[model samples]
Target: MEDSYRHKGMRRQLVKVVRSKGIKDERVLDAIGKIPRHFFFENALVEHAYQDKAFPIGAGQTISQPYTVAFQTELLNVKPGDKVLEIGTGSGYQSIVLLELGAEVYTIEYQKELYERTRFALPEMGYKANFFFGDGSLGLPRFAPYDKIIVTAGAPTVPDALIDQLKVNGCLVIPVGNAKTQQMLRLTRLEGNKLRKEVFHDFKFVPLLGDDGWKK
Candidate 1:
């Protein structure tokens, strides 16, 4: 069918653009290529889903741009079968990407509406990210000791609680800065009570809402 060919072409184009823009991980690329982003959007935006742009999914959150999703996944250092905790379930796109990378994910989101939307969509998409409704910035204490963690929403700063929940040597990738702007931050756990911070370029995302994030 012509429609199927067009969908495949769009998928290939998305991967080409994302890689040219510096998405280096093959696993990340493959994951991005496979997921049907349109299914995560309102039907009106289905045609635009593969355009590599973020779209407003109700409840004050936007599905992150495709490249950013790939970037965060690569930075989180996901390994096959790693236990990954993702904060901010947002349109469930990022959670789907994590599942593609073979990570066992646990995700939390605050807005009740967005939480339920994602929960309903996950099983239908054949994804298995354990969904939780709560203040995401607190991080899921029940799923501590994760091999890697990622926060889809931007925070004012990294939370101490998240740092405590990581397994020693685990990696956490987050966006941290003032509400208006953000910088990508990578934290890797070192030996006993030690953490290494790596700061990358500036980016913007929806406010990470919780005690460790913006004033909410």
Candidate 2:
């Protein structure tokens, strides 16, 4: 549970691995180095925390792999004080990264257990984010028009509500595809409700579930 020197050293090595994999953003690399990923796992699995792979975080959800996290975050192009809406809080790892990068994050989780668990866990680690439990696909309308939005789970298609919630100049990063694999997409809202879309490489993620996502 303790973040000792050895754990910090391991995180440094993990940062190096992520860097070598072409995560050129220095701020993203630094956040990866600073966050104690081990703190998010059970003590028995803590040794594997620094690995680039994903691990089960209870509730059938897995914390995303490090490279995927870096890649998605880099695509987000986060800036300090940006109001970011994150779908799928999961282990709260990604939210912590955004918070570390000076973002004001509002995150939602569909699974009640995961939401409750992460809601408390994050603040305990000195990280803070507005946490909510609901259908993430609907987007948080109360806090709509976010400066940036990131969806952590894979959706069959980008939710229309998410696009509607984005600010005119805001960006949305999501993974879209079928159950098996997804293509990463970045959507930038332009004038006249138009959006500029860009596609990145493929990734695998748990299916996004909600009214706008996969049916229960």
Show the colliding residue pairs in model 2: none
lDDT of 2 by residue, 88-168 (tens): 999999999999999999999999999999999999999899999999999999988899999999999899999999999
Worst 10-residue stretch by lDDT in candidate 1?
Answer: 1-10
C-alpha TM-score for every candidate? 0.96, 0.99
Number of clashing pairs, model 1?
Answer: 0
lDDT of 1 by residue, 139-183 (tens): 988768888989988897789889999999999999988878899
Candidate 1, residue 7: Cα displacement in angstroms equals 1.5
Worst 10 residues of 2 by lDDT: 39-48
The regions of model 1 sitting more than 4 angstroms off are 1-3
> What TM-score does prediction 1 earn?
0.96
